[model samples]
Target: MYIPFDEMVDTSRVWIYQADKQLSTAEQSQIESKCNSFLQEWAAHGQALKSSFQIIHDKFLVISVDESFNQASGCSIDASVALVKNLEQELGINFFDRTKICFLVNGEIVEIPLNGIKSEVKNGNIKSDTLTFNNLVSDIRSFQTDWKVEAKNSWLKRYFQ
Candidate 1:
């Protein structure tokens, strides 16, 4: 069912989707409603899935499922992707663009194309200590502790060296 994100266990499976741009207040509200409805009806093999979601920095959508309750089947996973695809169509936002990298700059979220990372680093716009959003985290505990990490400590470290 639709559990509050805070109530979900730390080991819950997570998927983070970064929007190409920040979502407006209205867009966030619409997304919240749509997600809540989806989670309410989300099931795997007819068993309800305990899930919750968080919209972070108006740019990332973090979805979590307590798989200990019931493992998510391939079909259920596909359904979640479908929901994201529908939202992309409705909002004209690209949520699957892995080429756009996110970073925290002066307390604001900034996106740099993956190809531009080297130049940004060379220009000093991106530093080893810059906070980067690592969307590859696979579970809630890692999402909580490692999602936002310093560039030197993340996969982005290669750019620095």
Candidate 2:
């Protein structure tokens, strides 16, 4: 069921949820507890799924499953989504919005609206070397290595070009 995040292999499947705004300390604690409780009972086709989660920079929630043990079925995946939805409502946080781009600036998390990215880049706020969170990484290995990447190396590279 629930395992320490570090115990999951590098090949584990990863799902990243970005919060529209940074979470307060209380919210983070509440989220961690709720996730731990839900993951303990999370299963796929009645089989317990080995999984873990990480909350990064108070702005991202990463859930990973060691699919080698038991692949997450469609229903199981839906269950996880439902959990996120409920949390969103209860916490008044938006985790499903993909229209904001997150970047690490001076050790702070800065969010730029997707439609305003080009303008921000033009304003010299986002540079070719700006570290942006690539939430699209699908596995633990990539999540560790490429989750935070330079803007020029990410899909935003097109804008740089």
Candidate 3:
């Protein structure tokens, strides 16, 4: 069920899991292996799901699935959640933590608490031109194009306004 990510086309469904902190090299290797192993057996109601995953910037885990063959069912999704929970416990990494706001400062991804964003912007650490990761992208096309975009164009627009 695991396919080459590049060959999977741009219509695939995507899921992004952000780590609270960057993963170590060893942890990345182990996590990659675990993800590959999981994809090999991942299924949707007995139908194999064509899936692939990759680690980006040593932190974000991007999982894409070509659901053109079989849709991911409730059971399969729950299984994935369970897998992530197990990974969190085993690796001491929290993939479900969304409290940290991720953005680009001088081309580096910076994490800050949401409440502190205003201060960073006010202090000129983050400007109107700052690029932020729009991790809410739902498809491969958007993931490719809009994953990292200007803060003004993202859900943080209200803050900028």
Task: Pick the TM-score winner.
Answer: 1
- TM-scores of all predicted structures: 0.98, 0.98, 0.96
lDDT of each: 0.95, 0.95, 0.87
lDDT of 3 by residue, 1-161 (tens): 89988877788998899999989999998888888999999999799999888889887998888888678888988887787788899999999888888887776779998889889888978877788888889989999999998888877777777
Instruction: For candidate 1, write residues 1-161 as lDDT tens digits.
Output: 99999999989999999999999999899899999999999999999999999999999999999999999999999999999989999999999999889999999999999899999999999999999998999999999899999999998899988
After superposition on all C-alphas, the RMSD of every candidate to the true structure, in Å, is 0.6, 0.7, 1.0
Candidate 2 residue pairs in backbone clash: none
lDDT of prediction 1: 0.95
**Better TM-score candidate (1, 3):** 1
Candidate 2's C-alpha lDDT?
Answer: 0.95
The residue pairs in collision within model 1 are none
Which residues of candidate 1, in runs, are more than 4 Å off? none
> Where does the lowest 10-residue lDDT sum fall in candidate 3?
152-161
